[model samples]
Target: MDKIIIDTAQFQRTISRISHQIIEKHASFDDVVLVGIKRRGAEIAEMLQKRIFELANINLPLMALDITFYRDDLNQANADPIYAGVDNPIPIENKKVILIDDVLFTGRTIRAALDALLDRGRASKIELVIFIDRGHRELPIRADYVGKNIPTSRSETIQVRTEHYDGINQVALLQ
Candidate 1:
């Protein structure tokens, strides 16, 4: 796969800024839950949780969600099949949920995530936080907090690596 480099330093700064923004908007992490989509999204959520605690001195609940089976394109030939599992139980009934993901591509993943989350319980509100927001959304979903926006073709992909998962932190353009 062809690779293009994205500045790691800049990405960290963006994440820090987003964390601060989240804290500011909510004013407190009292009723906030951070739910990360499986794989890279989970890693980002962990980081966000840490940042939130560091910034606000509040320990927010963190959960991981797998929306692979709920994907609309699951039956497609190119859809990479993932063994779905719910690692963390969502216990935020009537609390605000901040869904975290590494990248927002087609927006279908977010839709599936919502379905899975609702199966567990209803949240007071659901906010989206994505590391990368690429255009060409096929669904009406939008992120509440985004680290970066990179416009690219549908054939391309954005790969995010964090120290929690890959032992490094970076974002790359892949083809």
Candidate 2:
């Protein structure tokens, strides 16, 4: 069966809450930069950026990251890897780096993201923000900011759909 975990309204609310949490912690986004994983994560990052701007008039810089090559299981995966490139022009040194991803599953992706991220520049702090944290961690990584925590099994899949990327805004569980 398939289950709808988060609908459009919930998705919007979650993004707003995440943005507020960032604002509360940083007070100002002067030294903050948002780095989103490729595909869906990029869309989420854009939403958060806009929400933060609306809330505090802060226009945080955003960078899109494609960790296709940094993945450890890239060779074992059944799909051809593609390079979409990363958008990081601003100096990340001594700045707060927030890595955004649609879903945090095995933490392997986050690990790869960290590797790709650090290779670019050294930041004072690096935090993770994930829309859904469906636990099945193979690594010791964890998200600093999580929109929702849905305990899931290995046989299930959690899909996050966004209007910007998927033509829909919702989170679904496929079993």
Candidate 3:
């Protein structure tokens, strides 16, 4: 069973606060790019773009990434890594990339994402934004912007429910 931690209202507040922080950090959106990890992460990035546009009236380019091929411990038993690349509509070269993800745990996923991103183009800067940071890092990666940090043991898990997938925005703790 999963215990609900952050509710929908709280999730919205977290996103709104993060959007403000984004605006405060960047002088302009012209040189900034939002790259979201597939599925939940992509949806959250879209929300961030909308929130930023709603607040500053500046629409930033958003890109979705699938990093399956870039994984170090990739199980290629079922799928081919070469065919795992997602469609990148915009170029990230010379732009400040804001890498978005739903959770940050082993940091391996982020390392894979970085590999996938660099394949597209060289970004001037790459900053991470994680909705939940569950702390069990196998690498030195960290999120520059985080919505919430929930420490968990190896036996526990954090599940982020989003509107598109779960019909609601909720963070749950599973033990």
Per model, state how many residue pairs clash. Answer: 0, 0, 0
Instruction: Give the Å shift of residue 44 in candidate 2.
Output: 0.6
Candidate 3, residues 4-90, lDDT tens digits: the string is: 999999999999999999999988777999999987999999999999999999899888898877888778457655543465568
Task: Spell out the clash pairs found in candidate 2.
Answer: none
- Backbone clashes, candidate 1: 0
Candidate 1 segments exceeding 4 Å error: 1-5, 77-84
The predicted structure with the larger TM-score, 2 or 3, is 2
In model 1, residue pairs whose N, Cα or C atoms come closer than 3 Å (at least 3 residues apart or on different chains), thus clashing, are none
> Model 3: what TM-score?
0.94
Candidate 2 lDDT by residue in tens digits, 1-175: 8799999999999999999999898966779999899989988999999999999999999999999999999899888888989876567888999999999999998899989888888999999999999998989988889999999989999999999767989999999
Q: What is the lDDT of residue 73 in candidate 1?
A: 78
**Over the stretch 1-175, how does candidate 1's per-residue lDDT look in tens digits?**
8464656687678778889989889866678899999988998888888887888888888899988788787888485686768776768789999999989988888999999899879999999999999889998889999998999899888888787777778888888
| lDDT of every predicted structure (CA atoms) | 0.86, 0.92, 0.91
Better of 1 and 2 by lDDT: 2
Q: What is the lDDT of residue 59 in candidate 3?
A: 91
TM-scores of all predicted structures: 0.90, 0.96, 0.94
* Predictions: Cα RMSD each: 2.0, 1.1, 1.8
